[model samples]
Target chain A: MPLSRVRIVLIATSHPGNIGAAARAMKNMCLDKLVLVRPRLFPHEGATARASGAGELLENARCVDSLEEAVTGCRLVIGASARLRTITWPLMTPRETAQKVVSHYDETDVALVFGREHSGLTNEELDLCHYLVNIPTNPDFSSLNLAMAVQLLAYEVLLASEEVTPASQQGQLPAEVEKFEGFVQHLEQTLTDIDFSDPRKSDKLIRKLRRFFMRAAPDDEELNLLRGILSAAQGRKSMRRDETSKE
Target chain B: MPLSRVRIVLIATSHPGNIGAAARAMKNMCLDKLVLVRPRLFPHEGATARASGAGELLENARCVDSLEEAVTGCRLVIGASARLRTITWPLMTPRETAQKVVSHYDETDVALVFGREHSGLTNEELDLCHYLVNIPTNPDFSSLNLAMAVQLLAYEVLLASEEVTPASQQGQLPAEVEKFEGFVQHLEQTLTDIDFSDPRKSDKLIRKLRRFFMRAAPDDEELNLLRGILSAAQGRKSMRRDETSKE
Candidate 1:
């Protein structure tokens, strides 16, 4: 089976539109399968409406009751939670998660499970899975929407897959989330290193750049290319400075 | 000039209660630096009550007027939003926003700016930020309390700072998301393709299943793993079905 064999399951969804949106997210990554556990509202126009253009996925979804039945034959169960619990399996970042799940493709069934809207997967439900996956989020605000989480992971999967390459440009691009973030972090370090973080601006130096790049929203691939260029230029400049000083 | 330099700023916040709560969230994530920009009513009884003993955050809270004063020297300004398009800067979801801010922490002071309760950061106020941060929410109802959003992003920054992940465990489980989600999705498709819909139980089946997975909440890495395995199973099942059809 190909990656298409995977399933994305949602439990106790309260909003119908979320189901549709989740379908859209999955489809955006070419994932078609969607399962709903217990929803407060479903088969509602509101939900389908929210699904936007992803109606096909919504129409082709599966509805289940118990968590057990939803994943009866699932050899691997991966749960989502923001909490760090006393009793549970090992947790992996999304990137690691992709590798582990793909590793199990030949051996058994697998399930990507999520909990409700207001509250996330409880400790009890997490026990079903051999592993847990946590999105690297701000601890101050860690609640991610069901569909958004699916979209984030789905995007990561595509990145990790054979189809993935640095988003093509003349040079390598920092398109991956973590990879791009690394550059941003590195750039910040460079600014601090150079003492160019204009203090008169009251942190305005970095804040403006955050706004600029965020608005610019460089794709990971593009970011890498740019950063590489930047460092190269900086490296040359620094070498010249060193030579001049020696003279 | 590490992430320690990044400051979370709340501006013209109307609710004293939310202010206290926000402090708690930041503290939990190990972020102490907070700046209040033109709070409507601060040092109020409500703020202290809601703070739940996180008085240090409030006591040490820097109170300033005008967004200009709050973010004067801050190099990076990230504004949180749910609605689209009114601000000058391009928008980013909370996750991306967090990463963007984190990247700039070393370069200059980064401000995680939040707006008023009545309407959120105004166009003018939001214009202060270089980038707008949107938390992915149900399109129908994407509103998240200010404190919750703070908690999530703060958590991510802490993770970013630590860099080192603990040995894999339930708290940080390594899931196989792709396979599990794929299985759940395939199972749903099978039921649909096979016409297993019990009219009365259709909703029940879907909802419960979704909730179950929600509880499972698989991460990015695991999803790819599950998808590979699931598509495999579905591929085999389809092949069998095709052979039977030929007969």
Candidate 2:
């Protein structure tokens, strides 16, 4: 819900589909507020069709004639730029911008302003911004689609928001050390039974396998599954031994 | 360039414009390899117009009949999924996936696969992937445009690729996809032969095993060791069968 305080402002956008796509991208990232300044077209079918399930955002978007009007209530304004300007401005990467927005979300409303698809924000439009955010791209082909740019920034914001939240560690808990060691022992025993390794000379091989599985950091369930497979392999070897003894 | 080793694959894309936009997005991120699997429309004007300055990518894009053909020669295969599946697979965030790709760039060819625009990837298609990458989105409105998804992922890859240094490259190279598949098949046969699993009912178990091994990311030498163990296990089973027949 912290993203509610952040507003996405598009300046003089030419393509209606870009506007719709931007709205969809914003909604996907949990940011809702949208302001269009001097859009060439709005309420067009192209926009509606492209918005998909995010039509509500376009319906609730505010239209303003000037950049100042669009960002009037914002305490912090960040301008998105693809080009490295000659003029001195506090430049930030998308991740830095997201961090700034997240840290300031409780204190103030933030505005992230994007520019025209072809020309981008003019000097006067950029002067109103406290910082300029640039998405790094290949130097030769630096042109990113307007909506795609929105998607990238919004994604960074979403990730940043999750990091700051208390419940960010949602992944499964890793297995305890004892349980993991047991699995390693089982693996080593199975390897020996299958004649894949000799107990005296298999230390290096076991160590390598240990390092790899340690990096994977399997959870309890994964560890149990692994132990089951080792048992199955061992079970096969014992069954073979019984048949040979009977012979 | 490390990114040159990364391929962007789109399967059964519906919109031509999305294809063009995806090409542009890839070019912007310095990734050029593109393979399309059964796109609904290609060589269309909509895609050409959307590609803008990146028309060359669209022109050079390889069109294939299936995902297998599209991902041929890749060592690592990562599938992008919007919906969280009931069956557990090793899931990675876009940033983590990007780091993985960049780290493995020196050792292997990587493929990032995206599925249909409306339905996304099928479970069977996902079975072929080593990992599932979920782009975090608002739970209520999780819909993300195909091109926009491609853009965000490519953006993250570009950033991660820039952060990696040559000295960071360590560890053994992973086995090729074909070899990995062969090993999986061998393990399945061994499991059946050992009477531990029935081929008809072991899909879920095999998938779990696949997920675990994929997370461990075994290299050629490690995979060879694993396959050797499977062969040894199968040898015991076949020997037991022969002894029983003689009795």
Candidate 3:
């Protein structure tokens, strides 16, 4: 519900595909509100094709003639800019901006604005924004795709929201220490049965193996499977010895 | 330099524009190594047009025939998956995977593999990966664009690389995928020799074992030790067979 308070606004977008892609990106991060200001083309086949499963977002999007009109009801305005302007404005990274939006979700209707594909936001358009959000990039090549910028910011917002919520713990329970030690003992015996190491000199190798497996933190099922493999391997040698004695 | 060591591998990508867009995203993040495995089309105008200023990466991209070849010589492989698989690989969020790669930057050449646009990586391809990374999305509509996935991951890698200090070295270098595969092959043969499971029906068990070991992520030395043990076990059985033949 906090994410729903954050709206994504695109100003004078040239590519319809970017608009659709942005919509899909927004939906992927659970943000549905979209405002487009004088986009060069909308309701085009390219936009629909790129929207994939998010065509409904496109159909529900509000279109306006100007940035001012787009942010009419928004309580907070943040502009996404690629480069710093001569007149400095408060700039925050995407993560910082996401935190700001989520923390202020209850009190504010937030509008996160993006600009055109080529020139980005104009000085006048940026002036309307209370703060600027910049996604860090290599100085030499900062041409981030329009939709990608949306994806990154939306992703950060989703992460921030999730952080506020209690996380669900999944995955199997780890193997008990005693059981782990039993597996280790079985592994050592199997190594000796195969003559891979003399028991006295194999301490370091066994320790290294132990350390490696310890990093994995295998669960009970995995440990049992490992023990079974060791048993099968050791059983083969014993069976072979029995046959040789019979001969 | 650490970021340079991170390679983005796209498997069976269908669109050239996505490839181009991915290159631009990587360049923006200061990552340039691009490996394409069985792409539908390359060097196309759509890709170049989409690449914008980062066309040089596309021109210099490495095209490979298989995923194995794509990840050759890499010390770590992480697959990007949209949904959780039935047999869960070690799952990490993009940020966590980025942290792992950056912390291990000194000793590891990392490969981040993205699967096809529609269906993600096959279980076989995933078996080759040490970890699976999922970009958290809205479950109702989790359709993430291919290049957008690349952008999100590359962005995280860039952020993590920037956070790396001079003294962040953390673990032993993981074994190269090629050598890891060799150990797995040797392991399968050893299992058959030991009569642990019929070769024809051991697929699921082998996958389970592979998943367990892949989670451990042994280094080159540890991998060699595993192979040595397998060989020792096989050698003992061969010796018994030879004695029986002589008799």
What Cα-based lDDT does every candidate model obtain? 0.61, 0.85, 0.85
Candidate 2 error regions (>4 Å): A165-247, B236-247
Chain B TM-scores of the candidates = 0.64, 0.87, 0.91
Worst 10 residues of 1 chain B by lDDT: B238-247
Q: Residue-wise lDDT of candidate 1 within B1-247, one digit each (tens)?
A: 2245778888788878779878866766667788998888999988887565467889999999787888878888888875786434687755576677666766888888877765788768866778887655444434555665676567557666766766355433435656565656764663343233334445656554544344445544434433332232233322212233211
Tens-place lDDT per residue, model 3, A112-220, is 9999998999888988999999999998888688999999999999998888533222356678999999999989998877666679887998998899888888898
Model 3, residue B169: displacement in angstroms?
2.7
List model 2 lDDT by residue over A123-203, tens digit each. Answer: 899989999999999999998899988989998899899985332132566799999999999899988776666699889
Q: What share of the true interface contacts does each candidate keep?
A: 0.15, 0.60, 0.57
DockQ of each: 0.06, 0.44, 0.47
Q: What order do candidates take by DockQ, descending?
A: 3, 2, 1
TM-score of each: 0.43, 0.87, 0.92
Using TM-score, give the best candidate's number: 3
Candidate 1 vs 2: which has more DockQ = 2
Minimum summed lDDT over a 10-residue window in model 2 chain B is located at B238-247
Pairs that collide, model 3: none
Q: How many clashing residue pairs are found in candidate 3?
A: 0
